[model samples]
Target: MRKFLLPLLFILLFIAESLFVQFLPGDFFGGNRILAPRFLFSALLLLTIFVGRKKGIIYAAIFGLIFDIVYIEIIGIYLFLFPFVAYVISKIMHVLQANIIVAYFVSILGIALLEIGVYEMDYLIHVTNLDFLDFLNLRLYPTLILNAAFLLIFIYPLKRYFEKYAEALRDE
Candidate 1:
């Protein structure tokens, strides 16, 4: 039951991404800004910090593959990116304190990494026509804002949950 909660929460976040886009007002000033939900990646970063890198990477791989299969035609993009981001966050956690304030910034870092990695990959494959400046203006800003809000709202509960879960696992 405890184990299932983590994956179930991720599944909810994954589904919520599309729902978020659907509910947001369709048009914005400044030529229709884009807000891609990277909430799961934020959770993954929290998972790495409060849980452990091993569990974090495992969940990342599972959820990443699901994300690719359901949300993308490209099969390997998130499949590769998720665990990669989690690994990087694990290393970063070694250098920085994992308190709420720093963790919030770290969540932002995770979102930024995921966003830039996607932009770069898409640019390389010619999937996106938006240039660097357009990417910054249209996608990065909105996406960061959206995911930042998510982290702000959920960070404490998530941190506490992960810490409790980790403690339980250690006891077993």
Candidate 2:
């Protein structure tokens, strides 16, 4: 029963993120810029930090595919990107000390990488008219700041929960 908690929490966070997006004021950006929260990614980052990269990659693949199926017209974009990002983060973890500040930056880096990958893919496919500068100013910076704040606010509790969660799994 305890094992189910984290996965259930992830699902709830996913739903909350979707709902939260709907509640955001439409003009919050006040222009063409968009400020969206990637709470799911933040959750995944916590999972990666406290659980392990292997579990993180598994969760990423499952959630990424779900994200693609529900939100995207294309099938494989997020499906491929999420796990790939998780894997990269897992690799990067070996070199960096495992600490709150490091984990926060790693989460931000993961979000940035995902965003850039999507932007580049869209640009290559001619799906977006926005150039690199516009993307940086309008999308990436705002997203990074918002997500960094999310990480700041939630990291400690999440880390404690996941650490305890992992310890329980090991004891069993």
In order of appearance, the predictions have TM-scores of 0.95, 0.95
lDDT of 2 by residue, 1-172 (tens): 8878888998988898899789987777666668767899788867887789889989998999998898888888888888899889888888998788898899899999999998898898888989999999999999999889888999998888888988987998
Model 1, which residues run further than 4 Å from truth? 28-31
- Each candidate's number of clashing pairs is 0, 0
Alpha carbon lDDT at 67, candidate 1: 88
TM-score of 2: 0.95
Q: How far is candidate 1 from the true structure (C-alpha RMSD, Å)?
A: 1.2
- Which residue pairs show collisions in model 1? none
Model 2: runs farther than 4 Å from truth?
A: none
**Which pairs of residues collide in candidate 2?**
none
Report RMSD for candidate 2. Answer: 1.1
